[model samples]
Target chain A: GAGVSQSPRYKVAKRGQDVALRCDPISGHVSLFWYQQALGQGPEFLTYFQNEAQLDKSGLPSDRFFAERPEGSVSTLKIQRTQQEDSAVYLCASSRPPGEKLFFGSGTQLSVL
Target chain B: EDKVVQSPLSLVVHEGDTVTLNCSYEVTNFRSLLWYKQEKKAPTFLFMLTSSGIEKKSGRLSSILDKKELSSILNITATQTGDSAIYLCAAKGYGGATNKLIFGTGTLLAVQP
Candidate 1:
C-alpha cells in the first residue's frame, strides 16, 4: 500500500512570506498528524486530526501556524509569515487510529531565508 | 506536559556489531511506545509496543517496553551499514480527542563497513 505522501519535497520562502505544506494520508486513514523537526532536534508535534475534524493544535508553535484536514485524508499545514526559526523539515504521518503505528511521509523541507 | 528523552545522542558501530537504543518518557495516560528508523527523509515505522504487546521483534530488530519504568529499548543484532540512520522513539499520550506523540531527541547511528 502507498504510504503517506507529502508534496513539494522542498520549499524555500523569504521571511514574512506565507507557505502551505500539503500532506496526503494513506487511504482510509482516519488520523493524521503534523510535526516539525529542526536540525539536531527531534520532531515536535504540530497538530492532529481525526477524520476531517482537527482535535488538537496545542503543539503549534504560534498563532501564525495553522492546519486543516477538510476531507479527512488530506491535510495542510500553513505557516503565515514564515520566519527563520520556522525553517525545518515538516513531516506528515497517518494512522488508522490514535495509538497505532503511524506511517510517515518523506516531509517537506522548508527553508526560510 | 509530556516529554520523551533518548540517551546517547549518537553511536558508531561496524557491520556485524550490536547496538541498543534507549527511550524514557514522562506522559500522562500513556498508550504506547513506538520506534522508527529515519534516514534522510521520513521515518519508517519499526515497532509499536503497548501494554498488551510489550515485546516485538522483526528480523535484526527487537524492542521491549517496561511500563513500570516508563522506558523502552530497541536492540539490533548483527548491524549492517544499511541500518545506519536516526533512531527515534515516541510515546503516545492517551485520553485525548486525538492521540498525541511526544518524540525523543533521537539517536544517530552510523554503521561502518
Candidate 2:
C-alpha cells in the first residue's frame, strides 16, 4: 500500500459489546505501534511489535484491550466488553528500523454508547 | 514512569502569527523527542529531535530540543489556517528497540484569518 491503512474509520459499540479495529502498515516495515487518543489529548502508546513478535504491551489500559500482529504486516486491536471510557480514537503507526519516523493511519474512532 | 507535558492547552492566533509550542518531558529510558499534528483523526509526524541545539525545519515548521532543560519547542513561522490543529509532543523511550512513545496532552492551535 502507499501508506498505512485502517478499517472502519468510525465505530459505535454498546457497552459490553466487542469491537475490532484493523491496521495494515506499510509493506515490509519492521516496526508497528498502536496508540489511543482521548478527546482533547495526545495519542498514548498502547503496544508495539517487531515483525510478528509482540515485544511490548505495557500501555494497554486493561485486560479488555488486546492487540496482535500475527503475520507482521497486518494487525488488529480487539476490545472486549467495551466501556464508555473506551470511547476514543485508536491509531496505528509503522516505521522502519531505527524507528525515527512513523506513518500513521486514519485511525478508528470508537464510540461506546 | 515516563511522562510528557505540553503547555498552553489551547491557543488562538491570526493566520500570519508565529507561535511557539512548548513540551517538557521526564522519560526513564529517554531516546528522542517528537512532534505531531492532529486535525481530525490521524496524527501526522512532524519532527524528531534526539540531539540538542540542532534545529530541524520543514518550511515554516521548526523544532529544537534542549537536553539540558529536558524540553523541546516547536515554532511555526507565519502560520496559516491550514496549520490550525492540535500540536502534540511525544517522547520515545528505550522500553525496547521497537520505540514506543509517551505523548503529552497536546497544544491546540486555532489560526483565524
Q: Is the docking of candidate 2 incorrect, acceptable, medium or high quality?
A: medium
Each model's TM-score for chain A is: 0.96, 0.98
In model 1 chain B, which range of ten residues has the least summed lDDT? B47-56
iRMS of every model, one decimal? 1.0, 1.3
Model 2, residue B63: what's the lDDT? 98
lDDT per residue as tens, model 2, A1-113: 99999999999999999999999999989899999988887888899999999998988999999999998889999999999999999999999987878899999999999
Stretches of model 2 off by over 4 angstroms after superposition = B95-98
Compose the digit string of candidate 1's lDDT tens values, residues A27-90: 9889899999999899998899999888888899999999999877789999999999999999
RMSD of each: 1.5, 1.2
User: Any idea what lDDT model 2 has?
Assistant: 0.92
Model 1 chain A worst lDDT window (10 residues):
A94-103
